[model samples]
Target: MGKTYCHPAMKQLKDQQTRYAPKERRLEQVERAEQLLGEIDRTKRYPYDYLCFRITGFRPDNWSALMIEGDEARRDLRQFVEDLSATVRQPVEQATEPVLTVDEVSKKYNVSTRTVTRWRRQGLVARRFVIDGRAKVGFLESSLQRFVAEHRGQVERGSRFRQLTDAEKDEIIRRARRMSQFRSGEVGLIEIARRIARKMARSTETVRLTLKAYDREHPDRAIFGPSTTPLDDDAKAQIYLRHRMGVSAENLAVEYGRTRSSVYRIINEVRAQRILETKLEFIGNESFDDSKAKSVIMAPLPAPADGKAPRRPKAPKGLPPYLASLYEVPLLDREQEAHLFRQMNYLKSEAVKLREKLDPAKAKTAALDKIDELQEQALAVKNQIIRANLRLVVSIAKRHVGPMNNFFELVSDGNMSLIRAVEKFDYARGNKFSTYASWAIMKNYARTIPEENYRRDRFVTGHEEMFEAAADNRIDEHEYESALKRMQEAIRGMLDRLDDREKMIITSRFGLGGASERTLEQLGRELGITKERVRQIESRGVDKLRRIAGEQKLDLPML
Candidate 1:
């Protein structure tokens, strides 16, 4: 053969062409494999194993190709193998571990084999199987130690794991024997078995078997008969009656034939059904009148006395009657009463002046607007009065401080009474405001006091009648009589002390027969003197009255 030396450039070009073709083919294969693997991963289980097997078959017998591809594939395959090994080993590791047999467990705890078996069945202890048909039962050593420690007092004195003491086991056996003996007689088999199981630390079946054995051993001792004095029809009827009347379960059990538990169950069932019925009735009858109830409980004030005008009593000169009585109840001195009366008169006069500034004819046309404005001002004054009344109620309520006293409730009731008094008061009445409010105050106190005793009950009833009568009469007769007497005495005394001009001034200012309470200016015009001169004469008259009062040691009644 001719010298087969190829050109270096041609050799290099051929090698490059060969290498590039395989690289392109490998990249395409990689892309296809990745796409297929992604599809498999999305759709099916065991994609890694499937893909590995598929790729292996695709390049069968190609060692170089397989080795190159296998390096990348082997990494994922190794991970899959590790995962599979863990899955397979977990349960196997759990199964092959040395577990205590039921007998061994029973012996360790000094309990019967049957008790261990029951514990395994109840999942209180872990269980395994052996080919020999003996169950491998186990509990964690720590758990076993903990259980032993918890019940160390009950364990046998000489036993290693502190299993049941011989004395305790013997006592349990004795109780079981007693229960088995009872079961052999006419007692309930299940209940007797359960009792034996609890006492012996064994299964119910074991107790039942023991009971059967006992019955067989002592056939002559075993007595069988129906329960004597079972619940009769009359007893059942009495139970039903008691249940219907809402008797307690314990009481019902003592009286009736059923157990306390049974009575409770029956009563609860009935109560639940009754509750359902009540709910249904409430839903069906949805005609409840909340407004009607409110109206009945808190009735609105009666329409103003006359159809054309609101009933507003003339402003009184002294404290309201009710307030005066409340204050004087604690025995306020005459000077204190007079001071309070003068302050009240000043407030009333100011209110009257404010009212007079508004034109009456214009007010009639814009009555609603005027009323709203007036009511706002009135509300502010009323709030002050309410605060004062609250204080009075507190004082009055304190007087009732003793056993069975509730000052807050008494105060609350008094407040309501005070509100009613304010509503019904006719300011036009010449009596002191406190006297008019007295009935309301007493009514509030009476409502809270129990009517158990004859004296208190009679007083409460009479007071209620008196309130009703006063409301109807629209005039406080007692107050009117007192005021009339006071007025006569005051006029007589003043007439004796005053000169002619002073007498006329006093009489005209008071308007003895009608329209009482004239201003200084009005009196000045009538007496042909400047208002200043009239004021001086009025001051002199007041001074003379005070001198007389001081000399006679008499306190003038609050005007």
Candidate 2:
């Protein structure tokens, strides 16, 4: 407890977590941080995001499910409370109860400082505080009384035990080495420390700290093999994977012959490695850092409670089947559009906030996975918005359709404009999304409709102009032209006999009318059908053409 240990959550609080630091009243935050010591169960591990949410009432931007516990979590939170209390702009007049410094507690209870340290090892809660410009350890009056009431005998007999001398420490180290060396059945430092503590009649923490101090002072001459050495990248990865799979740090500490704190440090270091290695992109918004951002941006969208969505206005009678389907999609009210846009932007803003802290390698499925989850949620919300407004695309397309431009093709182009509008629209401006989308679609049509008409007219010619063109000077030209005409006549005659769908599939597949041949997948996307369905239609059309040729006794090449 005396030595420095890196707590995992402390760095993440400054790096990854969203802090709820209100400038007006930080004393309440201090009180909340103090209350947490009793509320949090020390035995269980918890996600850092969930912890942040509980403390700050706001979910972090990169909401993760990384679980942390044991001495690592406890020490981090204690230091967090310490730092939190230190930052109170005004005096903390409303502390639930008075707190005593380490010296004060020792003097008040007639116990040695070692006994106070031992009391911490025996579950007497203590926190760090900066009082009168000096940082000191303080114990809550309530926590002290609780510890004393429970361990009266231990508290009363405190400091009667003397501190370990150099000889006793050396003897303890010798015993630890002997126990570890002679017994080769996966013995850890804890077992060695406990056995030595029992034989020497000292607290387990005292024995443990003595061995650590010795190893740290003389790194090359360590008692616990390579346990104190920094783990390789691969070993850190393995430990993190096991943690993701629900292995406790305690178990990892035992298996790796390291303290739980060391194991947690490695796990977070690997976490920091992955977060640094990943590439994340997001649209940043100033709204995310606001105090009430999560609640306001993530406000629930209006929906029918019965689970069945009520339809919007019906399409005009005798409308095309495709246009009719568009009308079936429910429209989003103003509230929902705002909610979705805000949520999408907010989610990305939080991710960018997390990405901003990449400089520190002090702390991932949970982190990276949480980022991925946020993206997926944002996408789902975007799609929901796009679908609700699709009828707008059809309405605009109906106006843009010309004799040369296909109605469905105009609708298809309008869809791309609508998607871009959804991405770029700022819902905070308090305007109708459809109005924006309509302008976007018309702007696209303004650029596209003229190009389409010009291309179509460029290839068209009058009959008199065609007749005036000169013929090629080749041998057997008339016979060759006659044969080519017959082949074309046969194909045209058969094409007239098939249905509209069959004709379209055959023409698109074979590149008729000098158009480039289209694959089944491309055609399926354009037709709103599966590739398999397109293939089936093409096959059926070809079979019909072959049967008609056979019945008519027509000679068609490659039939």
Highest TM-score against the true fold, candidate: 2
Q: Clash number for every model?
A: 15, 2
Q: Residues 262-301, candidate 1, lDDT per residue (tens digit)?
A: 5554444443333223311001111123434323322322
User: What TM-score, computed on C-alpha atoms, does each candidate reach?
Assistant: 0.19, 0.42
Best by lDDT: 2
Worst 10 residues of 2 by lDDT: 462-471
lDDT of 2 by residue, 58-86 (tens): 77755475667744555555556555555
- CA error at residue 132 for candidate 1, angstroms: 39
Candidate 2 deviant stretches above 4 angstroms: 1-91, 101-103, 106-139, 152-161, 216-222, 227-235, 241-251, 259-262, 277-279, 284-559
